[model samples]
Target: MGWLRGDCVGRGSFATVNLAVCSQFTTPTVVKSSDVFSSSSLKNEKQVLDRLGLCPEIIRCFGDDYTTENGEDFYNLFLEYASGGTLFDQLKNHGGRLPESDVRRYIRSIIRGLAYIHDKGFVHCDIKLQNILVLGNGDVKIADFGLAKRTEEKQSMCECRGTPLSMSPESVNDNEYEPPADVWALGCAVVEMVTGKPAWNVKEGSNIFSLMLRIGLGDELPEVPNELSEAGKDFLSKCFVKDPRKRWTAEMLLKHPFVADNTLSSKTSSPRCHFDFPDWVSAGTASVPCSPESVEWSEWKFDSVRWSNCTSPVDRLRQLVTDKKPNWSESDSWCLVSRHQRTV
Candidate 1:
């Protein structure tokens, strides 16, 4: 089906995410596009999503296509649009922290998604609040599978695949990204949700190397919020285990009392909130600015003879001045000091 691209909602280092409406659907969808040459990650995401297929807890991918605009080719992947934005957005709306009840609901959904991915022999290398999308009905789904890989795939040494704040001990030390590492990241997300702060106590301007050392070798774990219920704390305990082997798996966490209890309503009764694209400077479409015919390009041009590959200090100083004389203004002239002025 043909789709019309709408406002550009987001831009990453390698891709642009825009709202789109397909001819066959009434609801708007999201189209993530990247230049054909830099689309490997997007293509990988499409393949992984297709392999995992049809899990309600996971984000749905409609399909992908190649399109050309302004003589440039782009690869586009269509995704289910989450009008409610991300879990991080919800946290900002709710005063930086979510109620325990809400946290439980969200965590339950995430665990279910993780369980499914792990069961499929895949590991979601990155799992954080920003990666979780909330639907209009308050249901959350796991999104952004760019870093996902098969569970059996061995990670290269010294390569970190996720945000450092959420990195598990095993991931930090051994570059191992297994299912348990995701659970550790899940624990970080849980703490952030409950306290409205990062799980790790990383101070401003703190050395990242030292932090990694602490995470991998210092035997320190994120402090569980005292405000949390005993069951909630216990649940976090299972996730924060330093040893990956002992860490509770997603399947195991699903049965924990904190999440297993379904008496509490999981759905939000409030109306679905739409994200305001404040960061989007353009409307309808992204366009490149055309040079105005009124401006003279020749006047702005510099003499090619003025530049060179010289690296000496004298050469650098010579390059700073131009052949043309400076147009000095009134302010450029130094004021003469009065004779009455005394030296300080």
Candidate 2:
């Protein structure tokens, strides 16, 4: 009955996530954790998904908890499980580039998710291919709200916090940065989508300056293959603009001709179920090997799966299925999932 897969969907400075299956409901879910204290302490992620109003490009948060276990407070969270994995993993596994049209639609999804985040007044500070999740359908979802901050308060530059390669020029130079930075990240992701690697990456033992030379000062934008249509090149040009102020916003990018006029010629497959049981079932708790930094999360502490503000593990969870009030914040769900510890 206990079917959870514990592979890192994504890793932030403070958390890790794994895929899970809620056999009881026959629905796929994700689990995550901060791994500091008890497994019960978690933040539900469903609230974020609900709050964002359903961007198919972003992973949906389903349930979560923040509670005390073993005299320690832990944070656990959960969300929709993506079986297809992340764009980064796909890039490595697919081996050798994506078609320009395919890249366009992928970028469109990235923008749609970002647009939803911006509309909800949040900044997905950590936007990267690793955080871009792919579903059974070709659709993509942005995961990992651990570093996401929901605020209208804008920062003027160096305040950007995340992987540097995808950062905007202003973010890299410590100038005023805003939502536009996300576009830059999207552009980097597009580059990776088409090239099968990061737009800008430093070699082992290389200084930061050298990497910057390839991105900040160099013509890092890959040549739009001669095979690409003019509209595709134009879209990339807009994103690669050096001026952050002039960069496209999520909404603006969505209105681009490449996307607004594009159609999905390749049909999308409907959802298919993925379930394969194991020989061994966990006794009381399913515990997996996690880093000392993650020892707590690697253990199953599911007490705080939901808050009073939401539902409770003690109450008949099935009953809540009748009404629409059953959901949790993204952070909490991650904390909860981290404890289940199933890796497939």
Clash counts for all predictions? 0, 48
RMSD of 2: 17.5
- The positional error of residue 79 in candidate 2, measured at the CA in angstroms, is 0.9
Model 1, range 23-52, lDDT digits (tens) per residue?
Answer: 875666899998998776688889999999
List candidate 1 stretches off by more than 4 Å: 263-344
TM-score of 1: 0.75
Please state every model's RMSD to the true fold in angstroms.
18.5, 17.5
lDDT of prediction 1: 0.70
lDDT of 2 by residue, 137-162 (tens): 87888986544555546543212244
Which numbered prediction scores highest in lDDT against the true structure? 1
Estimated TM-score per prediction? 0.75, 0.63
